[model samples]
Target chain A: MNKRKVYIFLGFSFAYLAGMFSSDIKSYFIKEVYSTEYGNLVFKCDQAMREHFIAKQVVAAKPNAEHASSLMQAEIALIDCQDYDLARKKLLSFGLNEYDLIELSLRAIEEKSEDIRKVVEIHEIRYD
Target chain B: MKFDTIKPFLCALAVWFVFAYTYEAAYAGLRDNTLIDAGKHFIYSTSLTPIDPNIKKASLGSKLFEDVRLSFNGKMSCALCHIDKFGSSDGLRNSIGIGGEGEGSERLDSDGLVVPRNSLPLWGRGESDFQTFFWDGKVEKEGGKVRSQFGDYAPSNDPLTVAIHLPFVEIREMVNDDYEVKSSLKTESVKSAEKIYDRLLERVKENQEYVSAFDELYFLKLDEIEFIHIADAIKVFIQSKFRLQKTRFEKYVKQESVLSPDEVAGGLIFFGKGKCVSCHSGRHFTDFKYHSIPFVQAGFGKNGFGVDYGRFNVTHDPDDLYKFRTPPLTNVEKTAPYGHSGSALTMEEAVIYHFDPLRLISTENMTPLERSEFYKKLLASSEDSELIPYLDDDEVDTLILFLKTLSYEESSE
Candidate 1:
């Protein structure tokens, strides 16, 4: 090939490679950032849920003024830190096993958390 | 020129002609005067009255509405939920009540008690003709008799006054469901409400500014002051502040202004094909009747267990199952996360749920129990769902644009 033609061919090759690799690099960076953020959020939510469960149990066992007050405080604190799924689960437990109330609360909680769930799903990464 | 040379030019001319024709047709559709006439007819059919507020009473009520001392927790007020930024709504799917601090997402992220229902906007709430109150119409007037949780001994004959008594006694809304509050209130009964009201009256009496305002407005002595008077003043303020104002749509109907073509198309859909007017008719854009629209349930529902029986809870009638009062649409654009549970995040999603609920929800994500519950709701909604015709994305967009026309020219409060 002539010198000018060879130069043009090389330029096109470089451009193609740059475009392909840049997209892959961007995707990798986004995946890393999203996964890290999501992981931290999940860990915090799990910890909150555990605390909430323990607090609820303590209130149920004691049923005293101090315990009730503590439970109330813990509920607010835990709710702030808990994820949508954990919140839904805790709210469902409030119904005990009343099928009618359970059915209604489940529907309501699902609808309420739909937006948050969608965001979480987007950020969720499956290594498998 | 040769035939070959002229062929390309002819093709270009034909393309241009088609484009121009389509543009003209679209423009003609936008400017169709018949839509204007139809819109006028729909609006004129409803008897709309202009409001005349008692400025002095409303001013006093305004002060009372903003007073945090009214709540048992001393942290909440009427103005907390009914904020100006979210068009008098707290802007969350479920309202953060009593213990909730700050506003909007900040409150959502805070240690607030989630109220398990959307914070309804306050526009046109306590107007003369607006009698029904709450998502369930728990407080209402029929044939001059005001019926509420109070039963026979309703605190006031005025439905708004009766309605105003709820938040103070409500467990999560204004009163913290703590040991002290629970023991003092006993249960959520009329007697309990009266006790809370008495306490609130005493608190208001302590405030010299409020005491003077009440005296000036109602000519009542500090000892003579009652919760009814407080409710009455707040009612007056709500009536004055959130009463319906002339919207762009109203102006268009009156020939004072014009709507763009998209808005006009949306109006037609709302009134005609969409069948939104069936329930959402009248001056306040609500018939003030209960209807089942089968919106996706959100939060912990009214009855608990992720379900809300809506009107059934109030009436205890099988036929009234899953029915809720048709919410008024004045300043609706500002109230995000629409529906009883605040399921729909955007206006488009809200509209879509009316006709195509399944489109917005993922059945795959639902548990068997959730699926069964949804199936029951779907069955209940079938009749009303059939009323709304299918609208394309563009049509839904235009419909939202038309809804925007319903917004007030400026914030009234």
Candidate 2:
């Protein structure tokens, strides 16, 4: 095999691999940032709506009116996720009405409320 | 020199050349085909998104607007009330819902009932500035950003406070409820209203046509069938199709509208001395803010008496009393009798109210107040006439011509 040919084959392989991995890589980065934002908002909202952010399993075990409110706050914090529709369902099965769902989501976006970076990280870990 | 060496080299070269040519040709076709496929996929995928270029959503929006099921009764579509011919009011003083028929005047508080207020025109209400709906600025509220003020108006009877109107509010007690039907008083009894709402969703879901449309564009989760989405979709439809008709005034400003000199002069009076510009600002001709002008409740009173507390009823604030939103003058020529109560029958009649509003300011007023405060400063002493300007009859005719230019009919297509 010629030296130039070896380089050409290598280049083509590299290009193909890059193209295949690009969207996933970009999505990962976006998810990370979004997760950071989501985390911060969840904390603020849990505090604002006076609910605590907890894992889905934990929430499911204690699905009561208070837990529902907490779930709503977390769901709002996670709304910017790519799988927000799914996240919303999981939250609602734990039980949240339409108005509560939307209101909480909007509240999470309020500026200067609290640190959302950690909540966003949690969101990334859960959804990403 | 050797026969073996020469023949072998030639054979090897020929094979190599052939393989290269075949590979190159195959790659060329693959590259072209891949490019085409990618472009097609991009176009198709984008069509499913909200900002799609092909505008499939807009087409769907048009179809939904034509769907009659949106009304409480299957008979009343948005088009029935806000028709093009009738100035968007069904040509009646008040609109009839599920209940019996009545003029706008008759819909006022009678038998301990009222239709709330006259139906607002849909044209240009989709403008971002016009978020709040109804007479009281109740639909989309404006609570300040302060944490304490958040949902400040939450407890109010505004439609936004609760996602759905109470069963009684939705049904039109158009006439005095002589039958004494308890179910009629509540929205819960409106004969399968929820089923109707569900059917609307089912129409979108079950219909093979809509399913394909949704699949092509984007799939909506069944659980997302809240009233807001329904309202948003309808809002989109109205925003997309029923755009306000552009007028000669637009062209005149751009030097494109053909206007006679007299009419042009009259146009200046409208914005300048006539003081129509203060409230009727922006492209669609309204600031979408509330104001109280001294105008009479021509028909019956919704809030009782001539004092129609506009935004006040919604806000329960003293400032908002009699302060209705300034109606956009988009199709003003057609959408009369003007005022919240539809009191003024003609533009001439309406304009005259602006000239001296004290007379019609309130039912108890000794003087007719100017219906439009925008013109009070413009009412020069030189204008001797109580109603229109003291300008020569020719200018008045010109003003009328200019006003005529504001007229626009919706596109038939």
Candidate 2 lDDT over A93-119, as tens digits, reads 444445545545555554433667845
Candidate 2 residues lying further than 4 Å off, grouped into runs, are A1-128, B1-55, B100-116, B140-218, B221-224, B304-307, B357-398, B409-413
lDDT tens readout by residue for model 2, B1-413: 99887998999999989987896566444333332232232211222112222356657655655555554444434554556566556554545544433334442333323444556666655444444556555555445321111233222333322322222135442222335434443333334344444555665565566556555555555554443344445555655554554566555444454566556445544543344544555555655677655455554445544345667676788656567776767667777767776666677666665555544345343234323322332332213231122222343455566576665634421
Per-residue lDDT of candidate 1, residues B325-354 (tens digit): 998898889999899889999999999988
Model 2 compared with the native: what TM-score?
A: 0.49
RMSD (Cα, Å) of model 1: 19.5
lDDT of 2: 0.49
| Candidate 1 chain B lDDT trough over 10 residues, lowest sum | B27-36
On residues A25-119, what C-alpha lDDT tens digit does candidate 1 reach at each position? Answer: 65445444443433443444444555557657977887885455344433433422433343334334433233433343344444435687754
lDDT of 1 at B298: 83
Worst 10 residues of 2 chain B by lDDT: B42-51
True contacts kept of 1: 0.00
Q: What is each candidate's DockQ, to 2 decimals?
A: 0.01, 0.01
TM-score of 1: 0.71
